[model samples]
Target: MKAKKIERKVSIALLFSITLLCCGGGQSLLAQANPAVFQIFEKYSKQKKVTLLEVSEELMAEYRIKQFKSIIFEDGTLALPEIRRCIEQDKQDAKKLKEATADGLVVSGYYRLKTVDPAMNRYLIFKVGKKNKVTLLYIEGRLTPEELVELLK
Candidate 1:
Protein backbone atom coordinates (compact mmCIF):
# COMPACT_ATOMS: atom_id res chain seq x y z
CA MET A 1 0.00 0.00 0.00
CA LYS A 2 2.80 2.38 0.80
CA ALA A 3 4.54 1.52 -2.42
CA LYS A 4 1.39 2.27 -4.37
CA LYS A 5 1.15 5.67 -2.75
CA ILE A 6 4.75 6.41 -3.57
CA GLU A 7 4.18 5.39 -7.15
CA ARG A 8 1.24 7.74 -7.36
CA LYS A 9 3.38 10.58 -6.04
CA VAL A 10 6.04 9.88 -8.63
CA SER A 11 3.44 9.83 -11.36
CA ILE A 12 2.09 13.17 -10.18
CA ALA A 13 5.53 14.70 -10.02
CA LEU A 14 6.24 13.59 -13.55
CA LEU A 15 2.99 15.09 -14.72
CA PHE A 16 3.86 18.37 -13.11
CA SER A 17 7.26 18.29 -14.69
CA ILE A 18 5.79 17.57 -18.08
CA THR A 19 3.25 20.35 -17.76
CA LEU A 20 5.89 22.88 -16.86
CA LEU A 21 8.18 21.80 -19.64
CA CYS A 22 5.70 20.98 -22.38
CA CYS A 23 3.03 23.60 -21.68
CA GLY A 24 5.26 26.62 -21.88
CA GLY A 25 4.93 29.13 -24.77
CA GLY A 26 1.21 28.45 -25.12
CA GLN A 27 1.84 25.06 -26.75
CA SER A 28 3.00 21.70 -25.51
CA LEU A 29 6.10 20.15 -26.95
CA LEU A 30 4.47 16.76 -26.43
CA ALA A 31 1.60 17.92 -28.60
CA GLN A 32 3.83 17.20 -31.55
CA ALA A 33 4.02 13.62 -30.39
CA ASN A 34 1.13 11.40 -29.32
CA PRO A 35 -0.28 12.71 -26.05
CA ALA A 36 -2.69 9.81 -25.85
CA VAL A 37 0.16 7.50 -24.94
CA PHE A 38 0.98 9.68 -21.95
CA GLN A 39 -2.65 9.44 -20.95
CA ILE A 40 -2.27 5.68 -20.66
CA PHE A 41 0.36 6.21 -17.99
CA GLU A 42 -1.88 8.55 -16.04
CA LYS A 43 -4.99 6.39 -16.43
CA TYR A 44 -3.45 3.13 -15.33
CA SER A 45 -0.65 4.22 -12.99
CA LYS A 46 -2.87 4.00 -9.92
CA GLN A 47 -4.66 0.83 -10.90
CA LYS A 48 -4.05 -2.56 -9.34
CA LYS A 49 -1.33 -4.75 -10.84
CA VAL A 50 0.29 -1.75 -12.50
CA THR A 51 3.62 -0.20 -11.71
CA LEU A 52 4.60 3.31 -12.84
CA LEU A 53 8.02 4.75 -12.34
CA GLU A 54 9.51 8.13 -13.19
CA VAL A 55 13.24 8.55 -13.23
CA SER A 56 14.55 11.65 -11.51
CA GLU A 57 16.15 14.36 -13.62
CA GLU A 58 19.30 14.22 -11.51
CA LEU A 59 19.87 10.53 -12.29
CA MET A 60 18.94 11.14 -15.90
CA ALA A 61 21.29 14.11 -16.13
CA GLU A 62 24.19 11.85 -16.99
CA TYR A 63 22.18 10.59 -19.95
CA ARG A 64 21.00 14.14 -20.79
CA ILE A 65 17.35 13.15 -20.49
CA LYS A 66 14.68 15.62 -19.45
CA GLN A 67 12.07 13.02 -18.57
CA PHE A 68 11.81 9.25 -18.42
CA LYS A 69 8.58 7.52 -17.59
CA SER A 70 7.83 3.82 -17.63
CA ILE A 71 4.85 1.63 -16.82
CA ILE A 72 4.48 -2.12 -16.56
CA PHE A 73 1.20 -3.99 -16.46
CA GLU A 74 1.26 -7.44 -14.91
CA ASP A 75 -1.58 -8.47 -17.22
CA GLY A 76 -2.31 -6.05 -20.02
CA THR A 77 -5.45 -7.74 -21.23
CA LEU A 78 -7.39 -4.53 -20.81
CA ALA A 79 -4.73 -1.98 -21.75
CA LEU A 80 -2.98 -3.67 -24.64
CA PRO A 81 -5.51 -2.70 -27.24
CA GLU A 82 -5.55 0.91 -26.19
CA ILE A 83 -1.77 1.02 -26.15
CA ARG A 84 -1.65 -0.54 -29.60
CA ARG A 85 -4.04 2.05 -30.93
CA CYS A 86 -1.95 4.89 -29.59
CA ILE A 87 1.18 3.36 -31.04
CA GLU A 88 -0.53 3.02 -34.38
CA GLN A 89 -1.62 6.62 -34.27
CA ASP A 90 1.85 7.86 -33.37
CA LYS A 91 3.48 5.68 -36.01
CA GLN A 92 1.69 7.51 -38.78
CA ASP A 93 4.02 10.50 -38.29
CA ALA A 94 6.99 9.10 -36.39
CA LYS A 95 10.18 7.65 -37.72
CA LYS A 96 10.07 3.90 -37.25
CA LEU A 97 13.38 3.02 -35.64
CA LYS A 98 12.55 -0.60 -34.84
CA GLU A 99 9.34 -2.60 -34.95
CA ALA A 100 8.28 -6.23 -34.76
CA THR A 101 4.91 -7.78 -35.25
CA ALA A 102 3.61 -11.14 -34.10
CA ASP A 103 0.47 -12.75 -35.41
CA GLY A 104 -0.32 -9.55 -37.31
CA LEU A 105 -0.07 -7.47 -34.15
CA VAL A 106 2.67 -5.13 -33.08
CA VAL A 107 4.49 -6.82 -30.23
CA SER A 108 7.47 -4.50 -29.97
CA GLY A 109 8.29 -1.12 -31.46
CA TYR A 110 10.69 1.80 -31.08
CA TYR A 111 9.82 5.15 -32.57
CA ARG A 112 11.24 8.67 -32.73
CA LEU A 113 8.82 11.51 -33.11
CA LYS A 114 9.41 14.73 -35.01
CA THR A 115 9.90 17.61 -32.63
CA VAL A 116 10.46 21.33 -33.04
CA ASP A 117 13.62 21.19 -30.99
CA PRO A 118 16.33 19.89 -33.23
CA ALA A 119 18.59 18.97 -30.37
CA MET A 120 15.89 17.30 -28.33
CA ASN A 121 14.68 13.82 -29.19
CA ARG A 122 11.52 12.07 -28.11
CA TYR A 123 11.19 8.32 -28.16
CA LEU A 124 8.47 5.81 -27.45
CA ILE A 125 9.27 2.19 -26.70
CA PHE A 126 6.67 -0.55 -26.39
CA LYS A 127 7.23 -4.21 -25.72
CA VAL A 128 5.16 -7.23 -24.79
CA GLY A 129 7.05 -9.76 -22.78
CA LYS A 130 6.08 -13.28 -21.65
CA LYS A 131 2.61 -14.00 -20.25
CA ASN A 132 0.97 -10.91 -21.70
CA LYS A 133 3.09 -8.59 -19.60
CA VAL A 134 3.39 -5.20 -21.22
CA THR A 135 5.89 -2.40 -20.81
CA LEU A 136 5.56 1.11 -22.17
CA LEU A 137 8.22 3.76 -21.99
CA TYR A 138 8.47 7.42 -22.90
CA ILE A 139 11.77 9.24 -23.04
CA GLU A 140 12.39 12.90 -23.77
CA GLY A 141 15.86 14.27 -23.88
CA ARG A 142 18.72 15.76 -25.83
CA LEU A 143 20.17 12.35 -26.61
CA THR A 144 20.26 11.13 -30.16
CA PRO A 145 18.75 7.87 -31.33
CA GLU A 146 22.12 6.15 -31.35
CA GLU A 147 22.95 7.32 -27.84
CA LEU A 148 19.54 6.29 -26.55
CA VAL A 149 19.90 2.82 -28.08
CA GLU A 150 23.36 2.51 -26.60
CA LEU A 151 22.08 3.52 -23.20
CA LEU A 152 19.41 0.83 -23.42
CA LYS A 153 22.10 -1.74 -24.16
Candidate 2:
Protein backbone atom coordinates (compact mmCIF):
# COMPACT_ATOMS: atom_id res chain seq x y z
CA MET A 1 0.00 0.00 0.00
CA LYS A 2 1.10 3.55 -0.72
CA ALA A 3 0.52 6.50 1.62
CA LYS A 4 -1.07 9.39 -0.22
CA LYS A 5 0.81 12.67 0.27
CA ILE A 6 -0.37 16.19 -0.41
CA GLU A 7 1.79 19.23 -1.25
CA ARG A 8 -0.17 21.22 1.32
CA LYS A 9 -2.98 20.66 3.83
CA VAL A 10 -6.08 22.12 2.25
CA SER A 11 -9.40 22.94 3.96
CA ILE A 12 -12.43 20.81 3.20
CA ALA A 13 -15.90 22.19 4.05
CA LEU A 14 -19.22 20.28 4.24
CA LEU A 15 -17.38 17.34 2.75
CA PHE A 16 -18.77 14.02 3.99
CA SER A 17 -16.08 11.75 2.62
CA ILE A 18 -16.88 9.02 5.10
CA THR A 19 -20.59 8.92 4.33
CA LEU A 20 -19.90 8.94 0.63
CA LEU A 21 -17.29 6.26 1.14
CA CYS A 22 -19.99 4.11 2.70
CA CYS A 23 -23.00 5.41 0.80
CA GLY A 24 -21.25 6.53 -2.39
CA GLY A 25 -21.15 9.97 -4.07
CA GLY A 26 -22.32 12.09 -7.09
CA GLN A 27 -25.56 12.95 -5.24
CA SER A 28 -24.60 15.69 -2.78
CA LEU A 29 -24.90 18.24 -5.55
CA LEU A 30 -28.64 17.55 -5.56
CA ALA A 31 -28.93 17.56 -1.76
CA GLN A 32 -27.19 20.88 -1.09
CA ALA A 33 -29.14 22.34 -3.97
CA ASN A 34 -32.47 20.84 -2.93
CA PRO A 35 -32.58 20.43 0.82
CA ALA A 36 -36.27 20.01 1.66
CA VAL A 37 -36.67 16.91 -0.54
CA PHE A 38 -33.21 15.89 -1.70
CA GLN A 39 -32.75 13.30 1.04
CA ILE A 40 -31.20 10.02 -0.09
CA PHE A 41 -32.75 6.62 0.65
CA GLU A 42 -30.83 3.42 1.29
CA LYS A 43 -31.05 0.23 -0.73
CA TYR A 44 -34.58 -1.29 -0.80
CA SER A 45 -35.88 1.51 1.43
CA LYS A 46 -39.58 2.32 1.72
CA GLN A 47 -41.15 5.68 0.90
CA LYS A 48 -44.28 7.63 1.88
CA LYS A 49 -46.08 10.61 0.43
CA VAL A 50 -46.90 13.41 2.80
CA THR A 51 -50.10 14.22 0.96
CA LEU A 52 -51.23 10.78 -0.15
CA LEU A 53 -51.57 9.97 3.56
CA GLU A 54 -51.18 6.26 2.89
CA VAL A 55 -48.36 3.77 3.23
CA SER A 56 -47.48 1.58 0.28
CA GLU A 57 -48.14 -2.12 0.89
CA GLU A 58 -44.56 -3.15 0.20
CA LEU A 59 -43.18 -0.39 2.45
CA MET A 60 -45.78 -1.14 5.11
CA ALA A 61 -44.44 -4.65 5.40
CA GLU A 62 -41.00 -3.30 6.25
CA TYR A 63 -42.42 -0.61 8.57
CA ARG A 64 -39.70 1.85 7.74
CA ILE A 65 -39.44 5.35 6.33
CA LYS A 66 -36.47 5.89 4.09
CA GLN A 67 -35.64 8.95 2.00
CA PHE A 68 -37.18 8.10 -1.34
CA LYS A 69 -39.69 10.01 -3.46
CA SER A 70 -42.38 7.86 -4.99
CA ILE A 71 -42.18 7.88 -8.73
CA ILE A 72 -44.71 10.28 -10.25
CA PHE A 73 -45.40 10.87 -13.90
CA GLU A 74 -47.65 12.73 -16.27
CA ASP A 75 -51.37 12.25 -15.47
CA GLY A 76 -50.44 11.96 -11.77
CA THR A 77 -49.76 8.30 -12.28
CA LEU A 78 -47.29 6.45 -10.06
CA ALA A 79 -45.32 4.15 -12.27
CA LEU A 80 -41.71 3.05 -11.89
CA PRO A 81 -40.95 3.45 -15.57
CA GLU A 82 -42.47 6.92 -15.81
CA ILE A 83 -40.73 7.92 -12.63
CA ARG A 84 -37.42 6.83 -14.10
CA ARG A 85 -38.12 8.83 -17.23
CA CYS A 86 -38.82 11.94 -15.19
CA ILE A 87 -35.65 11.45 -13.15
CA GLU A 88 -33.52 10.98 -16.23
CA GLN A 89 -35.12 13.85 -18.12
CA ASP A 90 -34.84 16.15 -15.11
CA LYS A 91 -31.05 16.21 -15.35
CA GLN A 92 -31.60 19.33 -17.43
CA ASP A 93 -30.74 22.83 -16.22
CA ALA A 94 -31.23 22.43 -12.48
CA LYS A 95 -32.14 26.07 -11.93
CA LYS A 96 -34.66 26.28 -14.74
CA LEU A 97 -36.12 22.97 -13.58
CA LYS A 98 -36.36 24.09 -9.95
CA GLU A 99 -39.13 26.52 -10.91
CA ALA A 100 -41.02 23.80 -9.05
CA THR A 101 -39.66 20.34 -9.79
CA ALA A 102 -38.34 19.19 -13.10
CA ASP A 103 -38.99 15.69 -11.86
CA GLY A 104 -42.50 16.50 -10.67
CA LEU A 105 -45.59 14.48 -11.54
CA VAL A 106 -47.43 15.84 -14.54
CA VAL A 107 -51.14 15.21 -14.92
CA SER A 108 -52.59 15.22 -18.36
CA GLY A 109 -55.38 17.74 -19.08
CA TYR A 110 -54.09 19.69 -16.08
CA TYR A 111 -51.03 21.61 -14.80
CA ARG A 112 -47.94 21.22 -12.63
CA LEU A 113 -47.20 22.80 -9.26
CA LYS A 114 -43.91 24.61 -9.35
CA THR A 115 -42.25 26.71 -6.64
CA VAL A 116 -44.49 28.61 -4.30
CA ASP A 117 -43.26 32.13 -3.56
CA PRO A 118 -45.22 33.02 -0.44
CA ALA A 119 -43.26 36.17 0.21
CA MET A 120 -44.90 38.17 -2.55
CA ASN A 121 -47.85 35.91 -1.99
CA ARG A 122 -47.14 34.49 -5.41
CA TYR A 123 -46.70 30.82 -6.29
CA LEU A 124 -46.28 29.22 -9.71
CA ILE A 125 -47.83 26.05 -11.07
CA PHE A 126 -48.22 25.14 -14.70
CA LYS A 127 -50.14 22.77 -16.94
CA VAL A 128 -49.45 21.67 -20.50
CA GLY A 129 -52.53 22.15 -22.61
CA LYS A 130 -53.55 19.77 -25.36
CA LYS A 131 -52.33 22.20 -27.97
CA ASN A 132 -48.66 22.11 -28.93
CA LYS A 133 -46.38 23.54 -26.19
CA VAL A 134 -49.32 25.33 -24.58
CA THR A 135 -49.21 25.72 -20.79
CA LEU A 136 -51.07 27.33 -17.91
CA LEU A 137 -49.28 29.02 -14.96
CA TYR A 138 -50.84 29.16 -11.56
CA ILE A 139 -49.89 31.87 -9.08
CA GLU A 140 -52.33 30.84 -6.41
CA GLY A 141 -52.98 27.59 -4.56
CA ARG A 142 -55.52 25.31 -6.15
CA LEU A 143 -54.31 21.70 -5.91
CA THR A 144 -53.40 20.05 -2.65
CA PRO A 145 -51.97 16.57 -2.17
CA GLU A 146 -55.45 15.31 -1.48
CA GLU A 147 -56.57 17.15 -4.57
CA LEU A 148 -53.95 15.29 -6.58
CA VAL A 149 -55.90 12.06 -6.33
CA GLU A 150 -59.15 13.75 -7.21
CA LEU A 151 -57.60 15.66 -10.07
CA LEU A 152 -56.59 12.40 -11.65
CA LYS A 153 -60.17 11.17 -11.45
Candidate number of the best TM-score? 1
* Pairs that clash in candidate 2: 75-106, 75-107, 111-127, 112-126
Question: TM-score, each model?
Answer: 0.78, 0.18
Lowest lDDT 10-residue stretch of candidate 2 = 35-44
Residue 43 in model 1: shift from native, Å?
0.8
Task: Indicate the TM-score of model 1.
Answer: 0.78
Deviation in Å, model 2, residue 6 alpha carbon:
60
The 10-residue segment of model 1 with minimum total lDDT is: 26-35
Q: List lDDT for all candidates, in order.
A: 0.88, 0.30
Give per-residue CA lDDT, model 1, range 22-68, as digits (tens). 67853653545444588899899999999998996788999989889
State model 1's lDDT.
0.88
Q: Give each prediction's root-mean-square deviation over alpha carbons.
A: 13.5, 16.5
